[model samples]
Target: MKFVNVRNAVALALAAAFMFGATGCAGETERIESVQIPGVWTGAGGGRVEFGDDGRFELSGIPSDAVVFSFIDPPPKGEKVSGQGTWSVKRKGSIVGLIYDSTGSFAEGGEAGTLGVADGGDSPKLYFSTSSDREYGYEIHKSG
Candidate 1:
């Protein structure tokens, strides 16, 4: 009887350990916002964009909706164009790429290289650069 009881106790302890190990302390979807993007960034052609974790987005000093984008900038306040698409990230060393679909009133959608993100208070702002290097940088503000 003693041997059987010890065996059962050991089995229970092992099972509990396995369960805890399988379920980590934090969920995978829980995004740990790191100091990656936050400050102001320039975009294509003298365009200015700001990002805040406080749930606000401004384009050319006008509040705007969170429209999906591929390469083009979000419609500048009162533009008929509305961008809808998906965005993915590819990383290599200190560089990142943002690829997306330019659906809805866009010319063509494809892969684009990510320049860098400026880490700021609460939210990190995403930035994009042009191949010509002459056009102003583009900023990606966070959406609520």
Candidate 2:
């Protein structure tokens, strides 16, 4: 029947919308000095980084210069990666980013890293660069 077909179409539309919105990435967020940016951020694939309130950080399962997520590229194989070090937030013009100086698994050719932060929503947003050109990155939501 015509009514049945229309109802099915409406249902499909709602389902699609729900799936799209379920990603949980905030559309607009800005993390500044005044905003709290210290928390545990879990990667979509596998890994967690803790930004401490005392300008320190501890990482688990995070590889050096990790380009995480199967959607981007295949993750590195072998032993699980871990690291610990200091971190700070720096502002350059309108952009505010988190800079890390770490050791452990992140020591080998991966001493320094930067992550763009955007907070102030229900969750925070962190843009992780996966390439050298800075053309591609992953936008991950804050887990806590």
Candidate 3:
């Protein structure tokens, strides 16, 4: 009777661990899938970004004050500064490459350090960290 009880307890422990591990992995995958980019995103301060399925993007209402420290000569600021370019996702959707149009910041090209879904919202909020230090970024909401 004692041996049978010990074996049952061990089996239960293993089963619990397996279940927990499987659930954890599934949750991570779901989180990644939630960050879909092919849509219009509007930010808090009137900023907007549109990502199309053809790898093209357009932006308006981006703040002029947002500066990238990595650039030797950052783009100039103006009341109406819009950007258009192509974008690509890599590293299993963790990294984003932004190739801006000729008239905007990083006209050559730039990479967003991280991409993820914002917390505590029923609607999906996409967050992109523009700087490696994460000092500058955008939090935009998906449009219906």
Q: Highest lDDT: give the candidate number.
A: 3
Per residue, candidate 1 scores C-alpha lDDT tens digits across 73-115 of 6556645432223322223222223223344444455413233
Q: Is candidate 2 or candidate 3 better by TM-score?
A: 3
Which regions of candidate 3 fall more than 4 Å away from where they truly are? 1-35, 67-72, 76-80, 105-122, 130-136
lDDT of 2 at 9: 49
RMSD of each: 18.8, 16.6, 16.9
lDDT scores of the candidates, listed in order: 0.36, 0.49, 0.53
Give one digit per residue, the lDDT tens place, for model 3 in 1-144.
676445434533443343334333434422333246788988877888898988888888876554222332554665534777776664354334455545565443432223344432457665554443442256677889
Tens digits of per-residue lDDT, candidate 2, 1-144, equal 676445434533443343223322444435455245677778755777777788777767654354332112233565455667666554431122332233455433223445555344566666555443443254445574
Ranking by TM-score: 3, 2, 1
Q: Assess candidate 2 and give its TM-score to the true structure.
A: 0.53
Candidate 1, which ten residues in sequence have the lowest lDDT sum? 23-32
Q: Each candidate: how many clashes?
A: 16, 1, 0
lDDT of 2: 0.49
Off by over 4 Å in 2: 1-31, 63-80, 92-102, 108-110, 118-120, 132-136
Residue 84, candidate 2: alpha-carbon lDDT? 71
